[model samples]
Target chain A: MNSVFWTHLVKDLRIEWRSLDAIVSMLFFAGLVVVLFSLAFDPRAAVSQGIAGGVLCVATMFASVSALNQAWSREIRHQVMDAQRMTPSSGAQLYFAKVLVNFIFVTLVQIALAPFFFVMYNLHIAGPAWVLALILPLGTWALVCNGVFFAALSIRSRNRELLLSLILFPIFIPALLGMVQATTAVLTGDNDPWLWIKMLTGYDIIFTTVSLLLFDVVFHAE
Target chain B: MKKAAFTLFPLITILLMVWGYYQAIYVAPDDALQGYVFRIIYYHVPSASVAFCFFAVSLLGSIGYLAFRRSDPNKAQIADAWALAGAEVGVIFCTVVLTTGPLWGRRAWGIWWTWDARLTTTLVLWLIYMSYLLLRRFAAGPQMQTLAAVLGIFGALDVPIVYMSNRWWRTQHPAPVFGGGEGSGMKDPTMVHALLWNMLAWFCWGMLVLLLRYKVERRHQEYAELEAEEALASAD
Candidate 1:
C-alpha cells in the first residue's frame, strides 16, 4: 500500500511538475484577484489591514479553488484516477497525496502573492513573514481537503467549476473566517492569533478524517 | 400513498404556522430592550433552526446511502432525492436567516449588516448549502450521492466552527442569540419563547417545502428516464 501510494503520488507530482499548468493558472488567478481587490478598495495600508485580511481570505479561496479544480479535474478528465484506482493504494493514501500536492501549489501561490501584496497594499508582514509561515500550510490544508472532495464530485459532472464552488464554498466559510481573522491579527500586530489558528487546525483535522473515510465513495461513486 | 402524505403535510404546516404566529405575537411577551421588532426573532430563529434540521436530515440520508451496503438503485435514488430536498429547504431557511438577520441587525446594531459572528456564520451556512446542491447537480449516480453525502456531513460539521470562529477570535460579530440559557448570559424569557415558537413554525414550513420538492424531484427523475426510454424505443 505504501509503495502503491508513493508511485501514484510521485506520478501525480511529476505530472504537475512537467505541465505546471495548475500552479501557473492558480497563480495568475490569485494575482488577478488581488489586483482586482486592490483596485476596487484603493485601500491605504492603514485602512487596508482590516479589509486586507478579508482580501487575503478571498484571494486564497480563489487560489485554492483554482488549484483544486485543476488537480482533481485533470485526474478525472484524463482518466488518471482510473490508473490510481487500479493500484493497491487505499483511498486515504490517494486523498492525502492529492491534499499534499494541492497544499504545495496553494502555498507557493501565497508565497508569490505575499510580496506583491506587501508592495501594493503596503501591508507589513509581522514576524518576517516566517513567524506566520505556518498559516499557509495550516490554512491550505483545510481548503485542499474540501477541494479534493469537491474535485472528485466535479470530475463526474459536466459543469465542474460551477458545481465545485456551489458545493465547496459554503462549507468553506469557517476556514475563510479563521484565516481572515488570524491573518488580520498577525498583520495588525495582535501578538497572538492562537484562537484563529486553533479554528483552522480543528477544521483541518476533522475534514481530513471525514474526507479520508468518504473518498472511496466519492472516487468510485459511478 | 406518497401523494396523500404530501397533501397532509401542507395542511398541518398551515395550521401549525398559524398557531406558531399566535404564540409568537400574542402569546409571547414583548421584550424590554427591543420591543415589537424583536418579534422578527420568531421568524429568524425558527428559520435558522429549520436550516439545522434540513442539514441533519440530509446528513442522515447521505449516511444511509453509504452504510446500506447494497446496490439498490431505488434506495440510492430515494436517498439522493431526500438529500436534495433537504438541501433546497436548507437553502430557503438560510435565505430567511440572512434576510431576518439584517432586519434584526438594523434594529439592534443600528446597521444594515455587521461583520458579527451570527451574520458571518449564517452567510457561510447559506454558501455551503448552495454548494451542496450544486455538487449534486454536477455529479450523477451513487457516486454523486456519496460525494454529496460527504458534503452534507462535512457541511454540518462546519456549522459549529463557523459559529465559534468569531467568538474565539474576537471578531465583531454578535454572540449566539439562543444558547439554551446555559451560561450564555442571555436571560430574556420572552426572547427565548419567541425564539422557540418561531423555530417550530419555520421547521414546519421547511418540512412542507421539502416534501413538495422531494415529490417533484422524484417525478422529474421518472420523467427523464421515460424520455430516455422513449428515445431508445423510437430508435429501435
Candidate 2:
C-alpha cells in the first residue's frame, strides 16, 4: 500500500471518470467491431458460438489500442512528465497506476459489449460460465499491461499509433492465443480450457513483471 | 595488413560459396525418397540457421548496450552498433528463410503454409525482429537506444514460449531434421558433408555482411554525435 502508487492510481481513475473519454470510445469501437464481425462471418448459431471467443478478444484488442495510444498523452502534455521525473517515488508506481486505470477502462468496455454477444451472435456457453470471470479479466489485464508499456515506448515516434500496434501485436500473440482458445473452448465445451487459461496466466505474470522492472528505465531514459 | 584482411575475407567467402554450390549441385548424392528437389535444404536450412544465430548476436548486443550504457557510454555505442547490425542482417536472412521455406513446403508438403508450431513461430519471430527494426527507424531522441534495447530483450523472452508451443500442441511441421532424439536424422554421409559445406559458406558470408553493417552503423553513430556537438556549440 505505497501511498504514491495508490495516489497515482486514484488520480488517473478520477481524471478518466471526469471525461469518460477512453471508455466511451472503447465501448463504441468494440460495439462496432462485434457487429462488423457478425456481418463478416456466417453468424449462424453454430458458427457464431464457435468463433465468439475470437471475435470478442479481437474486438477488445482493437478497441483497447484506440484507448491505449492516448493513455500517456495527458502526461506528455503540460510538462507532467518533467514534474513526475522530479518526484522521489519510483517510476514503476506511475506505470502500474496507468496500467491499472487502463485495465479498468478496457474492462468497462468489454462489459458494455457483452450484450452484443447474446443479441447479435446468440453465443451460449457450453462449459461453465464462471471461467469467463477469471479468463476475461486475465486477458484484459494482459492486453492493458503490455499495451500501456508499448504505448509509452512508441510515444516519441513519428508513427506512434502504428508503432504501438506493430510491436505490441506480435508480442501479444501467445496471450491472444490463450484467450481465444480458452474462450472458444468454453463457448464450445469441446476441449479443456485449462491449458489456455494457464498460458494466459503465465503471459500476464511474465509481462507484468518485466514491465514493472523496466518502467523506470523507460521513464527516465528520455 | 588489416585492410588486406578486410578485402580478403569477402573474397574467401565468395570462393567458399562457389565451392559449396558445386558440392551441393554436383558432388552430393540425391535423396532416395525425394531426389533433386531435396537440395533446397542446403540453402534453406543454412539460411534459417544463420538467421537464428544472428538473432542471438543481436540479443547479446542489446544486453551489452544496456549493461554498458550508464557506466561506459563509449562501449554502449559500440554495443548499439552491434545490435542494429545483427538485427538488420538477421532480418535479411530471416526473409530468405521465410521465402525459401514456402518454396520447399509447396513441393514437400503440397501446401504453401500451415499453422503448425514451427511455421507459426518462425513467422512470429520474423514479425518481432521487423518491429524491432521499425522502432529503430521511427523512434528519435537519446532514449531511442534504451527503448530499442528493452524491446530486444522483451522480444527474446517470447522465443522460448514459441519454441515450446510445438510440445504443448500437435504440430505439422516436420520434426528436427538433424537432432531429432536418438540419432542424426540424415543417414547419408555425402548429404551430411555437402550440408556441412553449405552451412560453413553461409556462416562466412553472413559474418562478412554483419561486420560491414556494424562498421556502417558505428560510423553513423559517430557522425550523429559530431553533428549534435556542432549544434550545441552553435547554440551557445
Candidate 3:
C-alpha cells in the first residue's frame, strides 16, 4: 500500500514536471498580482510591514488555487479519476498524496516570489528569515486541501470557477485570517506568533480530516 | 380510516397555525430595546430553527437511501420529498433570518451589514443549501439521488462547524439570538404560547408544500411511465 501510494504520488509530480505549465503560470500569476499591488501604491511607502503579509497571504491563496486547478481539474476532466479509484491504495492515500504535491508546488512558488518581493518593495531583511519558511508550506497545505475538495466538486459543473469560489472562499476565512496575522507577526518580530500558529494547525487538522473522510464520495461523485 | 387520518392532520395543522399566529402577534412581550420590529422574531426564528431541522431530515433521507436498498421505494421517495420541502422552507426561513437579522442589526448596531462571524456563517449555510437544491434538480436516476444524498450529508456537516466556530473564534454576533439555552425557552410566558403556535403554523405550511410537491412529482413519474408504455405499444 505504501509503495502504491508513493508511486501514484510520484507519478503526479512527474506529470506536473513534464507539463511545467501549472508552476510557470502560478508563479507568473503571483508575480503579476504582486506587481499590480506594487503599482497600486509606492512600493517603499506601501510595504507597510502589515500589508506585505496581507499581499503574500492573498497571493498564496490564489497560487494554490491555480496549482490545484492544474493538478486535480485535469484528472477529473479527463475521467482519469476513475482509473485512480481502481488503484490498490485507498482514497485517503490518494487525497493525502495530492495534498502533499499541491503543498510543495505552491510553497516553491511562494519561495520564488519572496526574493522578487524583497527587491521590489525594499523589505528590510532581518534575523533568520527562516521562520517565515514554515508559514508558507503549512498555510498553503491548508488552503490547497480546501481548493482541491472544491475543485473536485466543481470539476464537471457548468460554471466551475464560480462554483469553486462559492464553496471555497467562505470556508477559508479563518485560515486566511490566521495566516495573514501570523505572517505579519513573524515579519515585524511580534513577541509571539503562538495564537496564529495554533489557528493554522487547527485549520489544517480539521480540513485534512474532512478531506480524508469526504474525498472518496467526492471523487466518485457523478 | 387512513384518508380520514390524513384529512385530520391538515385540519389540525390549520387550526394550530391560526392560534399560533394570534398569540405571536398579540401576546408576546414587547422588547424595550427592539420594540415592534423585533416581532419579526416570531416568524424568523422559527423558520431558521425548522430550516436546520429540515437539513437534518435531508441528511437522514440521504443516509437511509444509501444504507437500505431493501426499503420501500415509496418510503425513500417520501423521505426525499420531505427533505426537499424542508430545504425549500429552510431557505425561505434563512432569507427571513438574513433579512430580519440585518433589520435588527441596523436598528441595534447601526450597521446594515457587518462581517460578523454569525452573519457570515449563516450566509454560507444559505449558499450551501441553495447549491444542494440546484444539484438535486440537475441530477437524475439513482446516481442523482446518491449524489444529492452525499451532498446533503456533506453540506449539513458544516452546520456543526458554523455553530462551534462562532463559539471558538472571534465573532461580532452575540450569543444565540433565540434559544441559546437560557431564558426559559421563550423570553416571556405569553411569548412562549405565541412562538409555539407560530412554529406550529410554519411547520404545517411546510408540510402542505411538501405534500403538494410530492403529488406533482408522483404525477410526473406516472406520466413518464405512461409515455414509455405508449412508446412500447406503438412499437409493437
Candidate 4:
C-alpha cells in the first residue's frame, strides 16, 4: 500500500529482472548443493526419505546466503544508503523490499530445483503435501527475514560474507530444525507435522517483527 | 580505595575458590552410585549456572546499550562494556560446562556425550554466543556495539526455541541425559552443600573476572574515544 515499499520492491525486482545475476547464481549454487548431496548421500539408500528434507533446507540456506550477502551490494556501491537516509521513508520499508526480492529469487531457485529433488530422491509425500506449500515458504521466510536483517547488521563488518554466515547460521539453527523435521514428518508421515509447522510460523513472526522494529536503529546508525 | 579493591577482591576470590575446592573434594560425601567421579558436579553444574547468569547479564547490557545509545551516549558505552564482559565470561564458563560435563559423563554415564535436550541446548547456546563474539571481533565501525547487541538479543531469543525443539527431537528417539530429569542426582544435603559452596566460589571467581573485564573495556572505550577526538582535531 505504501509507495516507498512498492517503489523499493519494484526497483529491486526490475534490477534483478534485467540482470538475472542473483537468480542464475543462486540456481547454480542450489543445484550444486542438490547434486553434490545426491552423490554423497546416495539417495537410493533406504534413508533417503529421512534425509531429503534436510538436504532441501540446507540447499535453500546456502543459496539464500549467496544472494543475501550481496543484496546490499548494489546500494553500498553507489552511496545509495546516504540517499536512503535523506529520504523521509523509514528503513523498514527498504528492509522488507530486499527481503521480498531475495525471497522471490530463492523461491524461484527452489522451484527449479524441485524436479531434481523429486527425480533424485524419489520423494513421495506420504502426508498432506499441501502443508509443504505452507512449510517451505515459512522456512524460507525464517531464513530470508533473518538473513536480510543480519546482512544489514553485518554490512559494515570487515569479513562481511564470512561474518554473515557465522552470525546467521547459529540463529538460524532453530528454524533449520523446524524446517527439516517438519519436512521429514510430511514426507514420511511419521510425526505430526503440525507441531513443527507451528514452531516455524512462530519463529518467523517473532524474528520478522524484531527485524522490522530494529531496522531503523540499524539503518540510521553512524 | 579502588586500588585496594582491585587487589583484595581477587585475593578473596582465590581464597573462596580454595575453600570451595576443599569442601567439594574433602568434605562432601562421595556418591555410592557414581563413586569419586560424582565429584565433577561441584565444578560442572556451578559453571553452567554462572554461564547462564552471565549471559542474562549480557542481554541486559545489550538492551541498556540500545536503549541508552541516543539519549545517553555515555551510559550506552558503559552498557556496551558490560555486554562484552558478560559474553566473554559467560562463554568461558560455558566452555567449562561443555568440557567438564564430558569428563563427568565419561566416568558417570559411560558415554562422553549425547543428543539430549539439555546438552544440545547448552551446545547451541555456546555456538550462538560464540558467533556473537566473532561478530564483535570481525566487525569494525561505530555501529559494531549496536549490531552485536541486536545479535545478542537474537541469540538469546533462539535459546528457548532450541531447547524446546531439541526436546521434541529427542522425544522421537530419546537419548540419555545427565540426571534423570531436570538435572543430575542431588538428593543428599552434603552434596547440595558442596554444590552450593562451589556455586558461590565460581560466582565469586566469575564476578571478579567480570568486573575486571568491565573496567578493562571501559578503559579501552575511553582510549578509543580519545583517539577519535584527537583525529578529528587534527583533521580540522
Candidate 4, TM-score vs. the true structure? Answer: 0.95
Off by over 4 Å in 2: none
Ranking by TM-score: 2, 4, 1, 3
Prediction 1 TM-score vs. true = 0.85
- Tens-place lDDT per residue, model 3, A142-189, is 788888776776665656666666567656666776677677777767
Model 3: what TM-score?
A: 0.81
- Name the 10 consecutive residues with the lowest summed lDDT in model 4 chain B: B171-180
Docking class of 2: medium
**Candidates by DockQ, descending order:** 4, 2, 1, 3
Error of 2 at B93 (Å): 0.5
DockQ of each: 0.71, 0.77, 0.28, 0.81
RMSD of each: 3.6, 1.3, 4.1, 2.4
Better of 1 and 2 by lDDT: 2
The TM-score measured for candidate 2 stands at 0.97
Model 3 residue A175 lDDT score: 70
Candidate 1 structure quality by residue, lDDT tens digits, B47-96 = 77788788777877777766663667677678778878888888887898
Give the alpha carbon lDDT tens digit for every residue of A72-171 in model 1.
6676666677877777657788888878877878888888888888788888765335547767678778888888877776777778876777777777
DockQ, candidate no. 4: 0.81
Worst 10 residues of 2 chain A by lDDT: A115-124
In candidate 1, stretches whose alpha carbon ends up further than 4 angstroms from where it belongs are A49-53, A76-78, A126-129, B1-13, B26-29, B69-73, B170-179, B182-205, B218-236
- Writing each residue's lDDT as its tens digit, candidate 4 over B1-236 gives 98998898889889889989999999988788778987887898889989999999999999999999989999999999999999999999999999998888777767889877888888999999999999999986668898989898889999999989888888322233234665445667877787888888999999989998999999999999999999999999
Cα lDDT listed for each candidate: 0.77, 0.89, 0.72, 0.89
